[model samples]
Target chain A: MSDKLISLLSGIIFGIGLVISGMTNPEKVLSFLSISHSWSAEYKWDYSLIFVMGGAIITAAPFFYFLKNKEVSSLGLKISLPAKQDIDKKLVIGASLFGVGWGLVGFCPGPAISAIAVFDPIVLVFLVSMAVGVLVKQNIIK
Target chain B: MTDFTPYSALVGGIIIGLSVVFYFFTTGRLAGISGIFENAITNSVNRFSNLFFLLGLVVGPLLYYNVIAPKVSIAFNITDSYTLIILGGLLVGFGTRLGGGCTSGHGICGIGRLSTSSIIATVIFVTTGMLTVTILQQFGIYL
Candidate 1:
């Protein structure tokens, strides 16, 4: 199929996965992050997040390993994996900040995108702010 | 205690993995949602594909909710405060861009490829995320 079509299909599948995995649910995500809650009888820490990651890793790791050296994909496009390998301050600081945001609302990029279908007013606000944040990083912050 | 859905989580995750693999196979690119979204706005090359992907992402859940399973309700319990939501969005947007990837890129696709930077990024974000939650709960500020 065409590249655009393929991309569209992949995104749909990914979105469905996010919904099924409960990643779209902020409460469930918060529960997963609140590991300490597991110790309290009144609260139960959800292990669904771990299982989701584990499932994705197990399913994708072998494929990636095999394709590591491949220069071209099945569609004859050049394989474009990330080239940067350094664990620098940018990565650390940025990730820390992202984590804080995620913990605050339990909305990451993937889940946030998927949650758009819910038509929640908060989702629209978050998305617009997120876009502005990206612009700030690319233009002002840099 | 009542919200655990391990089986569905695993199944959904595997499906996500497959989508990542499929995207790679077709476009020879990693299916990083942040990167895709960023490029869709700023970059020109492959912008159409990125847009299409995002369109599909939105459509996916709609289709599921409207057709696949109409009875299933989506549980979304986030804070009603618009201020917190907006702040969280800004942080996530800026952080993901500055860091070069988000959960899909660094956590799943990156880790699967065994990239060192991705692994470190994932570790930091996940740990920090947990810490943030823990600290917030300590303050009795559960969102």
Candidate 2:
């Protein structure tokens, strides 16, 4: 298969996983984030996020470890991983902003993209805004 | 909890992990959505493949809802307010770019590789996310 095809397949499978895991649902995500609500009698905190992350981590860790020392992948493509090891200010500030947004709307990039299939107006708005945000960061916020 | 779906969540997570592995094996690239999206937009290298991957993200859920599980309707019960949605989107987009990766990138693939930066990113994001929810709740802002 061509590289593009492989990428397409990988994305499809990833999207399916997101949908199946209920990550595409903003309400579900918010429920998981709202841990304080677990004690509330009216609302129940969702634990699916924990299970989903745990399952993915467990399944992918071995492969990552195995490939740690390899220069190339099974298909002969040169492997490329992030090499940055330092925990810098940019990382901390950026993550904090992302977290606040996620908690506020329960929409992250992956799920936001997946939610496009739903044909909701709000999703479109959010996506367009997200694109603008990216553009701003890349071009203006250097 | 009334909305728990442990079995499906685990199954879905495993599928996600496998997808990341498959991507790495075939393309020798991490399946980090934000990175892919960012590169697809700003950089020309592997732009087509990145776009295809993003296209697949949309198509995957489309196929699932329309064919594989027609009974499961896609729903977003969260707030329909455009102001909040746009704000959240901007933050997520800017933050992911500035920070390096989002949930899939930092939470799954990053941690999977045991990257220290990724681990710290994940902890910060998750903790802040929970704190955001708590703060919002205190103000009666149920999103």
Top candidate by DockQ: 1
For candidate 2, lDDT tens digit of each residue in B71-129? 99776676777778889999898999989999989999999988899999999998899
True contacts kept of each: 0.80, 0.81
lDDT of 1 by residue, B39-122 (tens): 999899999999999988888899889898899997777878787789889999999988989999999999998888998999
What fraction of the true interface contacts does model 2 reproduce?
0.81
In the range A100-120, model 2's lDDT, one tens digit per residue, is 989889988989999988888
Residue pairs in candidate 2 whose N, alpha carbon or C atoms collide under 3 angstroms? none
Worst 10 residues of 1 chain B by lDDT: B1-10
Question: Per-residue lDDT for B14 in model 1?
Answer: 97
What's the distance in Å from true for residue A37, model 2? 1.7
